[model samples]
Target: MALDGLDHMELEESKGGSGLRQYYLSKIEELQLTVNEKSQNLRRLQAQRNELNAKVRLLREELQLLQEQGSYVGEVVRAMDKKKVLVKVTPNCRVALRNDSYTLHKILPNKVDPLVSLMMVEKVPDSTYEMIGGLDKQIKEIKEVIELPVKHPELFEALGIAQPKVEWST
Candidate 1:
């Protein structure tokens, strides 16, 4: 009876050992699967991070290019604006215009006397005057009108011709 009891106890011990081994192996397999899944997730996140970084770099380059273009355009506009001419009749009375703006400058007695006295008269180019087609009659009329102002200042005042306004570029 004692020997039989001892044999049964040994059998029970072997069964328990087998069960524990199976449980431990199954737990280890589950842990390995979890570890592999986490590693895959980490790799995917790293790839996404790299793509985002590349996009940010591209955007920064584009922004820098735009800023440079903006500054260049600003410089061009400033140069264009600086090409204007400022005409001052008196110290307080001033008018500004671009060189290409007006067809002619109507000379008054006061203005002509100063220019003639200073010998600063500039002859108008025939090509410039001829560019205004159908203005022959107008030019003749303007010459006739200006003759009185040049010859007689009192007559011009009586005729009441105002100071001409300055023109700007198109």
Candidate 2:
């Protein structure tokens, strides 16, 4: 009788041990799956962070270039009131006019003020001083006042004087 009882107890313990092992294995698999899912989520978030960082770096570089090249003024001009027709001056000092279609038309000028108003913007002349026959003396005087400084800037610098500016009177 004692031997039979001992054998029965051993059989029950063996069955319980097998059940515990299966349960442990299932738990480990579930934890591993959870860890894999979390890792994938972390990777996706990191990729988004990297992409945003790259975009911010590029924008900062572009802003720095604009400021360095004096094109920041153009940005300010673009930020003005939408109703006002503003003339945009490029960093290279080109005048940008708006056409009938509301498109920017870049016009190269011999000289332009960056702060010139839209009302003050004028079309480039197709005529020259020689085209006028009787204005020789007047043209010579105009050349001395205008062309002389442009042709020989050092002369004006030596004289410590700037070129004469003509102001229109109403």
Candidate 3:
């Protein structure tokens, strides 16, 4: 009976030990899985951080480029291939336009107003009158029609406020 009791006690001890080992093994596996998931999450966040950092770096570079003062300050002397130009930056130096610098050239077509100066009051140069020697009859006709109204002004009173205005042609 003593030998049987010893064998029974050993059998119970083995069962308990096996059960504890299995529980510990399962816990270790679960902990390992949790650690792996956390590590993957950390790696994903790090990668996203790296991508965002790269985009921020690009934006900073672009801002720096835009903020830089333009070195070319001159007229577009001539155009070349692919939006390039020869610019006169100074009295002596000529520069080739680079990196799509067309600010000056692009303004020329829209900025010019040829007829704007016609409203200005000006004296007719004497050299222009000296050039009209052969058109004697025509000049007399012109002086009668144009200068008569300006110099005399009594003719318009006879016509009764119907002022004669000459239209100029370009």
Candidate 4:
């Protein structure tokens, strides 16, 4: 009877030991899975950070070139999320239209306004322009309708066209 009880105790001990070992093995697997997931997450974030850094570097180079050109490129009226900027563009700026007044434009990477992108992105050094069919006619019309009014206001006045009252207050 004593030998039998001792045998039973050994069996129970073996069972408990095996159960503990299995539990530890499962725990180790869980921890390894968590580590792998964290590593993947880190890699994804690093990739995004690298992309954003590249974009920032490109933007810096563009700003430097604009500064060298001595053109009124525009001012960052507001910066939002490092991705978008509210730019106050002067009338002479390419992004600005006919009016001799400053205008606010929101410039973004992917969601840039069509007109703004046409005026801004076309100035890229690597871009090429295919001449449109009616571009010369459009230019002539623009010169007569917009440039003439601003450059020679007397011509509009002589044609009895009422001009907006411009305040030259400095």
Residue 120 shift from truth in candidate 4, angstroms: 24
Instruction: Return the TM-score for each candidate structure.
Output: 0.34, 0.36, 0.39, 0.35
RMSD for each of the candidates: 22.1, 20.6, 19.8, 19.3
List, residue by residue over 1-170, the lDDT tens digit for candidate 4: 35574576567568776755666688999999999999999999999999999999999999997765232346466667665556665422234222333433322233347787667744535522244454777778867776677778998899899765554322
Superposed by TM-score, candidate 4 places the C-alpha of residue 83 at a distance from the truth, in angstroms, of 45
Residue range 49-105, candidate 2, lDDT tens digits:
999999999999999977652222221144346554354444444444443344444
- lDDT for 103 (candidate 1): 18
Candidate 1 wrong stretches, greater than 4 Å: 1-16, 69-170
TM-score leaderboard ranking: 3, 2, 4, 1
Candidate scoring better on lDDT of 1 and 2: 2
Candidate 1 per-residue C-alpha lDDT over 63-118 given as tens digits, one digit per residue, 9 for 90 to 100: 99776521100011112244443344342222322244431233223223565767
Error of 4 at 67 (Å): 1.6
If ranked by lDDT, best first, what sequence of candidates would result?
3, 2, 4, 1
Model 4: CA > 4 A from native: 1-16, 69-170
lDDT of 3 by residue, 1-170 (tens): 45574576567568776755666688999999999999999999999999999999999999999987654445656778665666665533333234365344323222325587776659855566569779889888988888777777788889786547765433
Q: Which residues of candidate 3, in runs, are more than 4 Å off?
A: 1-14, 76-170
CA error at residue 94 for candidate 3, angstroms: 11
RMSD of 2: 20.6
Predict model 1's lDDT versus the native. Answer: 0.57
